[model samples]
Target: MTAPRKARSALDLATVVLSLMVGALGIWTILAGPTELLPIHYNAAGQADDWGSRELLGGGLAGLALLTLLLGGGMALAAGRTDDPARRRALRYAQLVVVLSIPLISLLIASASLSGATDISGALPVALMSLVILLIGAFLGRVGPNPFVGVRTPWAYKSRLSWERSNRLAGRLFFVIGLAGLLTAPFAPQPLGLYAIVGAIVLAAVWSGVESWRVWRTDPDRQPF
Candidate 1:
């Protein structure tokens, strides 16, 4: 595995910036945000904003703000350790996705109340943007010398071909689904849009693993560490 030395590049500074943006947006969202139509939570059952006005763990705007802080802090810290140029670049892209998400999701969720929508019409865009970010993260992890992220299937980590193939598949699936999610956002039902994003990713992950093994089996120079 390639290990990154302790150094902060100009790109690393950007990671700090990203966290700040997320943190700032989170604060703004929590302060001004009404009960969002969709909020990510721990429970699968899904609850409402019961944790008070400023509390994120309780739900609503607080939740996003808290997440922003955590994600921002995480990215900043990670940036300091990473060595690969590709991973660094990918992180930059990740910041853009995260930055775009604040207003897009906040507005979309608030719009649900105005639209009086059970699922709302804006979820497609949300899901799609998120999907793209997810993919970028995967690509960076796979290409970088990180043991913690990316595909990380036993086969993938063990073999160079597997890692490359799996990551490529992942990248393509994420890009396509993201586009599909955006285009399908208005036409498809909310549930369907969500499902499409989820399903496409799952399919890619599975196929990547299977394909990795196949490549290993066929290649004379197979290496599965």
Candidate 2:
């Protein structure tokens, strides 16, 4: 594990800006918008099924914005603590993902709140999730041992080689599924695309874990348990 240290970078600054944007959007929406209950929750079918006061929606967005700020700032400050260049790079990429998610999530919230219809297709959420997954997959293979990221498993943690191999496989799966999501989310039947995306993620995670365990079991230096 890498030690924690104070470090600052451009991405860290961007995170601050992104977080503020989310907060500002939420506040602005609450102050200048309809007082009717906003769509605060969506069902599996991608339809807004739950409603709440504008305060609920605004507060939730603000909370998420704060979390994003913390994660981004923390990751940036901690980036220099890791001696491994690969891990450092991976951390930065992860921060980027977190930072980017702020805008996408805010957009989803705004869309859901503003929409007058009850049955909105889940395309936007699916697309956003896919985009995030794709971005993460692009750099997942570069992530070294970190409890906070990558494919952490008993076997993966047992061996650096296993971790690398498992993450590489996971990265490919994520990229593939994300690409599939991007392609199908627009036209797929209601909820099917979401289900497919979830299924793909589960399959990838299971496969990666199994691969890690197998790799660990076959290692020449393995110790009997």
Candidate 3:
């Protein structure tokens, strides 16, 4: 059964409000801080090479808040309108991603603000990213058929079994990659460690996509695409 429109709207509003609250906190923190400049851009090596006016932080926070609202609201609306189990589950997963990103956005802004004074190593941001990846990996397998989440492809969408198995394998790969990133952050050079983590992500995504295609081809129930 589909969720009630009123209930779903309320949930979406709450989620957006929560995200705005976090954005407000982030902006407030940036404003109250002594730093005039915040690191807004990073190098491929994970180093914060480009700095910008603190106002940039405020702008970024606002953008993120708006994006969260749009994505979360859209998913909530979809969930409420659809009685299909797969679609609902997928929308829920997309909603979860939006909800989870709010805190990470706040943390990233705070980290950059703090780095202005302490020159904190790139490891901090890398660690935070790894944590996000770990959390996503933890639940990715449970995400149902959706265009917005998981390894979406013609083959995978044609075969439920292919999607499920590919996501399961992806979850394991992502988890291991995130764990490896966390473990490497403290001991390795900043850029190299970040590179390793990036490599892991690329590898996981490629492997899962390829696997999905392979599995779909072998599935007896899969229709010609």
**Can you give the TM-score per candidate against the true fold?**
0.58, 0.79, 0.77
lDDT against the true structure, per candidate, is 0.51, 0.75, 0.73
Q: TM-score-based ranking, best first?
A: 2, 3, 1
In model 1, the worst 10-residue window by lDDT is 41-50
Per-residue alpha-carbon lDDT of candidate 2 for residues 156-204, written as tens digits (9 for 90 to 100):
8887778889988988988888888888878887677787788889999
Expressed as tens digits, the lDDT of each residue in 9-57 for candidate 1 is 4434543554454456456545565464333321111122322233351
Clashing pairs in 1: 19-72, 56-62, 56-63, 158-224, 158-225
Supply candidate 1's per-residue lDDT for 6.
Answer: 30
lDDT of residue 79 for candidate 1: 52
Give the Å shift of residue 218 in candidate 3: 2.3
TM-score of candidate 3 against the unseen true structure: 0.77
lDDT of 1: 0.51
TM accuracy, model 1: 0.58
Better of 2 and 3 by lDDT: 2
Per-residue CA lDDT of model 3 for 1-225, tens digit only, reads 265556556567678777777678557755774456676766666556777776677667667777777777777778868888677866777677666666565656666655573333467667777877887787777777776767887888999999989988887888788777777777778667777788889989999999999999999999787
lDDT of predicted model 2: 0.75
- Candidate 3 stretches greater than 4 Å from native: 1-14, 25-35, 85-87, 102-106, 117-123
